[model samples]
Each structure stands twice: as C-alpha cells, then as structure tokens.
Target: MNRRLILDVDTGTDDAIAIMMAGLSPDLDLIACTTVWGNHDVDTTTENTLRVLDHIDHSDVPVYRGLGKPYAPIPFLFPDYADSDRTIVHPHDFPIASRTSDVRATPAVEWLVETLRAATERVTLVPVAPLTNIAAAITLDPRIVDAVDEVVLMGGAHALGNVTPAAEANIWHDPVAADVVFQAGFERLVLVPLDATHEAIVSLDQTRALRATGTPAAVAAAAIIEQRITGYNEILPTGAADTAPVHDALCIAYLLDPAVLDVAPYRVQIDTVSPLSFGKTIVDVDNRARSAANCHVALGADATLFNDLMFRTLSEGR
Candidate 1:
C-alpha cells in the first residue's frame, strides 16, 4: 500500500527532484503539494511547483500557497537591498536556483490542517521547506498534532549549516515555527538533516551517467542536477568537485527505502535565541542523561544506491 503523503515544499532544485521521486515511487501516494517561501519568494515557489507538476504529469495534485513571511515578524531584509541586512545573504543568490512569477489561490497552512482532518488515514507531512505551514496547521487545530502519523522534514544541521555558520535555510527562515513543531510532542517525527543530505551528493559524473537513461524524466532530472551542481560550484568555493546534494529528495527516498538512511534516536532542539545559532539543531550526540529524546535524525546515507534508484525509477517512467 502506498503511504499517503502531503508534500510541503519550496521548489528548490532539490525540491524538484523530491517531487519527481514522489510522483514515480510506488511506495508513495502523493495527495497534494503545498508551496512555501524558502528557497525563493512565495510567488516563485508556487509557480515553480506548478511547472514541476506539469513535468511529472502530477498537475492533478492540488498545489497550495503558504505564508508569505515568517510566523513571527521578521525584519524586511533582502539579499540585494543595500544596507538591508547585507550580512544575511539569501539562498537565492545561488546560480542553480530558479524563480517563477505566478501565485496561487489557497494558502498551504489551511490546506494542511483541513486536509489532515478530512483524511481517513493518518497523514504524513513531508516538509522540504520552512516550518511556517506546519506550525500554522498545528496552531489552527491542536487536534492535528494527534492526527498526523509523522512529519518527515529536510532541514537543520547536526553540525554546521549551509546558509549560515549555524542555521540552515529552512529553519532559519522561521525559527519559531520550527521550535513549535519540535516541542509539540508529535508521536513520530523524523528528520533528514544536512548530515544525511550531504552524503547524498550527485557528482557531475554521476549526473552524466544518468543522462544515459534518455527518458523524459531522466533527462529532466539530469538537467536539473546539472544546473544544481553548476550553481553550487559558482556559489561556494570548495576543494571538492562541483556537486549539489539533493537535499529535499532524500526525505521522500527515506520513506520509500528506509535503508537509504542511517538514523539514530536523537534529542533534537531548535535554538531560537542565539543570534548566531538561531534555528540550529542541537542534537545530544554525547547521549547525556538530561537531554529529552523527541526525534530521530539521520546521520548517514548510501548515495550510490540512491542515485541508482533515481536513475532506474525515472528511466522506467514509474
């Protein structure tokens, strides 16, 4: 039986890959997609989501727009706005990222809460974006906290983060929202953080190999992967070769193939106060007695097998 899922996303290149995986993976019954503002603005996220759905032939899956800003008031900051918090660079500066110009009718938060309440089975929220929508859903109806089977999120970093030295983009976008979800005492919440996503990087050579598949899905995937790596190389100066980790895709893959991820019971907490560590995920790796265990976090993964699955699944056009 396919697991019923609602994907909350901010269509980054990786988010596109995740959507493709959900559309093709037999293990998932993707009910809908909700767009958020993380990788880019809310408008772009919603538009790109439609474009991606069109590619995967999942246009029938209703897409909902989400919060335009953080759950709490955030300073009106822009990466390009001179003297407007220039220190905090937005992830959109990356080359591989794309932004769309359209917007949608419904917001994601309302869709999430109402959708779960209506579903006969416990719904799983696969959040590959900021936590604004999830937080809003729980706040709208506290009962949803129990109705949800699980929340599989792709954000946070057990170690260092990509967008900031301490904070990841998804969590940093809305730390308060993230904190609420982490402390809500949801029965089963799993996170595939940077620690695991970093392990699932698709190298340039690997992407070239994927192109050999020659299907529409495979070609589209290869094109996106290529754009992703090119952006990574241009944005971050790394000694290693150019490659972009398919961060969001791993969340769906983990649900489909648990063995692709190596998880450990972790006491996870979000830092809401520290200026430098806001949204940083604090894991009790030392296994101290005082840390409260609330979530399971993936620390390792098998990238080779993951890439193989992506190639085969997309090639077969499932």
Candidate 2:
C-alpha cells in the first residue's frame, strides 16, 4: 500500500515542488497539506498551497492553515531578508490566475492532533517549513509522536548555513519548536539538511527539459526551479554555476527512493540559547558526546536518482 503522508510547508518555491511531487506520486498517499509561517506569512503560504494543488489538478488534497508566528517569540533579533530578492521568501509565479480553494476550517494544530489520534494506520509527517505546527501538535498530544511512522524534514545543515553562518532559515526561524520536535523521541526522524540538498542541485538546462514535458505540474515546477536558480545565483551561489538546490523537494525524493540520500545516525541538538549559534543543528558527527543517535541526518544525496524520480513524477502530473 502507498504510504500515507502529510506535508507541512511554507509554500515557497521549493516547498511548491515538494507538494506537487507528493500530490502526484503513486508511491505515496498525500492525505493533506498544513501551512505555516517561514518563507512567507501563513496566509500567503496557504494561498500558495491552494494554487499548487489547483494547477496540478490535485484539488482534493485538503489544506489546513497553521500558526502565523513561532510558538514563542524569538528572543533575539535576526536578519529579516525582506529586502532580499530570493524567490524562496517571495510568492511563486504559478500559472494559476487565482486560488481555487480555501483551507479547511480546522486549524492545523488541531487537525494534526485529531487526525493522528484517529488514524488506524501510521502516517508519515513531512515538515519542510518551521516546526511550529508539528511541535504544537506534539505539545497538545504527546501520544501522536507514536502515531507517526517517520518524519523526513528538510532543514538544518552541518557544514554551512543558508540564513546565517550558523543557521538555516527554517530552523533559525523557530529554534524552540525545532528543539521540541527533535527531542520528542519519534522512532524515525530523518533530517535532509543543506549538506544533502546542495548536492542534489538542478540546473537551468534541466528545467528546460522539464518544461518540454508539456504537463501542468512539470511546467510549473520548471518555472519555480528556474526562479530558485536565479535567486541562488544572485544571493547564495552553489558549487555549480547555473544550478540551485531545490531543498524541500529532496525530502520527497528520499521518500520515493531512500537511496536518494546517504544518511547516518547522529545525536543532533538545536542551539536555542547562544545568540551567535542559535538555531544551529549541532550534529555530533564524531560522537564526542557519546549520546545515542536520535536522528538520521542526511549528509549526501544522489543527484541522478533525485532528478530521475522528480522529472518523471512531475511530468506525469496527477
């Protein structure tokens, strides 16, 4: 049977691609999408999620609006990136003229608690944005931690950071929530951090091939990826020229094919107190702490396999 999956997102460019892949993949049953604040405000993210589902003809997938702010206010100040031209923070240019559906009446945290409590089968939770909603759900109902089959989240980094020298945008946005989720003791927690995603970069030429597929999902994915490439090149240039990491989509790729990532067990902790290192995922790669591993942190990715799965899935549409 296909794995039951729920995607929690911020509906930025990369998150949009992840949603399309999950919504269209035959290997997964996408039960719903939960939106939160990260790359954009919660309201815009919800609208963007609707836009993606409508464009891909997957309107049946329910979306629930979640928290607009962190579980608690951030104690320290950080760069807002409001002036940055990065596409990840701005609204995506999907072909859909307008949103076709609204989010469900139930708040995301409540829906998560209810759904997990009532689920007869374990569900996979993929949170690519901030951990606010997921953390809130767990806080509300700690038993739901056992209800989840696995969590493949797209955030954090070992060697480098996207938002700052010490943090990725998602984790840095709300370290308290990330800390709660990490220490919640889920049986299987997979971290697809920048280390893995940067390795699975997509180029402008590859997007051209995607657009040539002539499917709505493929075309929209191509446009979104191109925007990412432009943003990355202008802001945070990757190892390769004309290529950019579709960070959130790599989490979906790992689900479709576990081999897409090279992972290892590690005791990862979030730095919540240090002003300089706040939101950083301190992965004990050397095992100096001698702590039992709580998370499977992805350090590498197979670009060829990722491209193959993503290209084929998005090209086929829903």
Candidate 3:
C-alpha cells in the first residue's frame, strides 16, 4: 500500500527536489503540500512549490500557505547567508511557466489539523523546512500529534553546523518552533539531519545521468541540483568537487526506503536561549542525561541507494 504523506516545505532547491520525489514516487500518496517561510519568504516558497508541481505535471496536489515568520520572536538577527553572492541559496532557477495550480484558501495549519484529525489511515508528516508550520499545527491542536503516524523532518546537525558554528539552517531559522515540536511527544519522530544529508551527496556526474533521462522532473531536478552543487562548492565546499547535499530530498528517500539511512534513538534538545548556540540540536548520543529517547536521529546515509532511487523515480516523471 502507498504511504499517505504530506510535505511541509520552504521550497529551497533541495526542498524542490524533495517535493518532486514525493509527488512522483508511486510508493507515496502525496495528499498535500504546505509551504512555510525558510529559505525564502512564504510567498516565494509557495509560488516555487506550485512551479515544481506544475513542471512535473502533478498539479493535482493541493498546496496551502502557512506562517510567514517564526512562531516566537528571535532574540538576535542571524546573518543573511542566502543574500550573499557566494552562497546563492535562492531557488529561482526553475523556468517560469504559467502556474496551473493555486494555494488553497484554508490556511496550512488549519488544513493540517483537520486532515490529521479526520484521517482514517496512517499519514506521515514530512517537514523539510523550518518547524514553524508543524509547531503551529501542534499548538493549534495538540491532538494532531496522536493523529500523525510519524514526523520525518530535515533539520539540525550532530557534528558541525551549516548556518552557524552550532546550528543548521532549518533549525537555526526557528529554534523555538523546533523545540516545541521536539517536546510534543509524537510517538515516532525521525530527524534526518545534516550528519546524514551531507553524506548523501549528489555529484555532477549523477546529475548528468538524471538529465539524460529526458523527463521533465529529471531535467528540472538536474538543473536545481547542479545549482546547489555550484553554491556548495563556492560556500560550504562539501569536501568533494562538483557535488552537493540535497538535504531535504534525503528525507523523502528515507520514507521510500528505510534502509537508505541508519538511525539511532537519542535524547534531542534544541537551544532557544543561548545566542552563540541558538538552534543547536543537543543530541545525547551517549545517554549522559539518561533521559528517554524522543527522537531517532539519522547518523549515516547510503549515497548509492539515494542516487539509485533519485535516478529511478525522477526519470519516470509523474
């Protein structure tokens, strides 16, 4: 049976690839896409989500707009790395085509609460952006936590941080929201963080194979990934030439095949107060705190498996 899933995204380049993977994969039944504020503004992310679905001919999936800012006011202003020319984080490379689908009138949080509350079957909540929308939904209706089967989010870091010296971009964007979600007591919470995503790098050679498929989804994904590679090489330097980590897409890949990642239960906490460590995910891997594990943190990823899945699914566009 196809797993029922909903994706909450901020429509970054990696998030775009993830949306395409979820929408195109036959293994998943993508019920809806909820857009939030992260890599770009909410409006840009929403429009980018529509463009991706339209490009892949999956406009049938409905989209709903969510919060435009973090749930709580951030204490300090982080550097706008996305605005820097060296980073080039914006996902504006997609060809501008006439949008066929529009965001629903109902707010994303409202729809998420209602859908999960009324669900008769299991539904996986995949949030590949900041935890704003998911945190809002939980606050609006705590019962939805019980309603959800699982939450596989793409954020945080175990070893090194991407945005700050101690934080990843998604979690660093809204540590308060991430904290709320982590403490909400979901039965199953799987965190696919930078530790694993960085390992699931997609090389330029792999992207060439994706482009050779000639499918619309494959072509678009290739272009987006190539852009990501260029940016990573310029800014982060993934230690590999002509390669980048499509972080968000790895979460979708994990849903399709559990073996794609190796996870271990850990007591995870988010730092919302410290200026130097804000948004840092403090994972207790050694049980120093001796608290019960609240999250399954992905420690490793199979890049070969990820590449195979991306090539197979994106090649056969929906």
Candidate 4:
C-alpha cells in the first residue's frame, strides 16, 4: 500500500535532493510536482524542477506551476545576502538543446482543486514552498481540506527562523497563505519545521561519502550539494565546518520512514499579529490545557540513520 503524494515545491538544491529521495522510495508514490517561489523565482524553480526530473530520469512526473507571489500586498525590500550574491545555477548547469516546455500557466489553486477531485485515494500534499498555492486551493473550495489525507509541509520554525528573525522562507513568503491553511483545520497534518531541519546537516564528508556511490542521481546530487555547502561556507561563518541542511530531504525521509524521527504531538498555531513573530509556528510541545492535538511535529531525528537512508535511496535510484 504505497502512499500517494503530490509534492508542491520551489526546487532549491535541497528540494532536488528531496525529490530524488521521494522518487527512489517504494512506499511513497510521487504522483505530481507543483513549482512555487522561494529559493529562486517561480520561473527558474520550474525550470530547475524539470531539469532535475530529466536528470533523475523521472520526467514523466507532471509538474504544475504554482503561485508567483503572496495573495495580498507585501512590503518588498532587496536584502544584500551572501546566498543572494552567489551565481544562479540551474540544476543542470548546461542547457538542454531541447526546447523548454511551458508550465501550467493556470494558477496552482485550480490544479489543486482539479487534482483532489480526481484522486480516488487520499492524496498527501507535501508542500515544501510558500503556502500560496495550497492556501488559494483551500480558499477556492473549503471542502478541499477534507479531500487531503495530510499536509506534510516543510516550513516554519518553533525555534529560530531561517529567513528573517522569526520566519522561514516559505512561511515568511506568505504568512497570509500559511494562516489560511492552518485555519482550514485539516485532520492529519505534520509540519517539518526548521527546529529539526536546522539540526540536520549533510557535511562535506557525507557528500564525499555519497559521491562514492557512483549513481547518476548520486553524482548529480553530490555536485549540487557541493555548490550548496560551498555557498554555506562562503556565506556563514561556521565553526563546525560546511554542510547543506538537506532541509526538504528531511521531510521526505520522515514521510518514507517515520521511525527515523522522534515526533511529538501538539496543538499548532501560527502567529501573524506580531511583526517579529508574524510567521512563527507556535507548537505547544507540551500538552498544555489538554487541547486537541493538531499536529505531530518532528522534535528530534537520528541524523546518521537519515543520511544512511538518503544514501541508500540515491544508490538504489541508480
């Protein structure tokens, strides 16, 4: 009994690794991919998704383009960051001679509604990007919430923020959207926030160890990971040496092997009122007031087991 999943993502290098992990998993069936805005612009994200699919020989997977920006007006400021200064590299640095295909120009909301209506089995919406598309979909039809089996999102943080002082890139990108989805009240939800992902990093040694697998996907992942880890080194002053967080990959790993993670159930809420805590995920790890638990969050994970699982997936994917 394979779990059917639809991955809505903004294919960052970490996203690519996650996709590869999902593709290789026998228990998790990846039915589709939807591109969103995060690590790069929506257009570039879609291109990277397609390129990675091609590289991993999984191009048959349908990729739908998602929301380009937030629903409401947002104050925009161009921040001078080291990661921003790095050259934008497509998944395949070399362009394919084949003409690029046009993405689903229609809104991600439409696709979500249509896909849910058509799904016979419960579909898990694994959104690893801003919640704009999912938010819009639920807004279109409130009943759409019932159609989903679970939403295993890779965003937010109970602890430190990844983007701003109190926000992860995905949640921060569209707090309004995140608010909508959380309020929709899906029955089964699991948020793989930064608290766990921040603790999970694949060091340069790990990448070198993986590069020895000799799989095309592994080799490509190693190369992209090399760029990411190097970027991290140049951007942040890290005392523990350099590594990529493998943020999105952690979500998929937990999906495929729940035992790899130590999860704690809790009542989840998103704080949108505070300027600093706007997109913060307020998860009551302790059963305070004995309210109904809304989510099962990964509190701790076995990093060694996770990396081993990732290596096995990439090796078998070859």
For 285-318, candidate 2 gives per-residue lDDT tens digits of: 9999999999999999999999999999999745
List pairs with backbone clashes in candidate 3. Answer: none
Q: Write the per-residue lDDT of candidate 1 for residues 40-116, one digit (tens) a residue.
A: 78777777787777776767777888887888764333242212321222233322233332344667787777777
Clashes of each: 1, 0, 0, 0
Indicate the residue-level lDDT of 87 in model 3. 31
Evaluation by lDDT, superior candidate among 1 and 4: 1
TM-score per model over all chains? 0.89, 0.97, 0.97, 0.90
Q: Give the TM-score comparing model 3 with the true structure, all chains together.
A: 0.97
Top lDDT model: 2
Which residue pairs in model 1 clash with each other? 65-108
Superior candidate under lDDT, 1 versus 2? 2
Sorted on lDDT, highest at the top, how do the candidates line up? 2, 3, 1, 4
lDDT of 3 by residue, 188-257 (tens): 9999999999999999999999999899889888888899888887788889899999999999999989
Looking at candidate 1, the ten consecutive residues that score lowest on lDDT are: 81-90
For candidate 4, write residues 232-288 as lDDT tens digits: 676543346876577788888888788767778888777666765666778887768
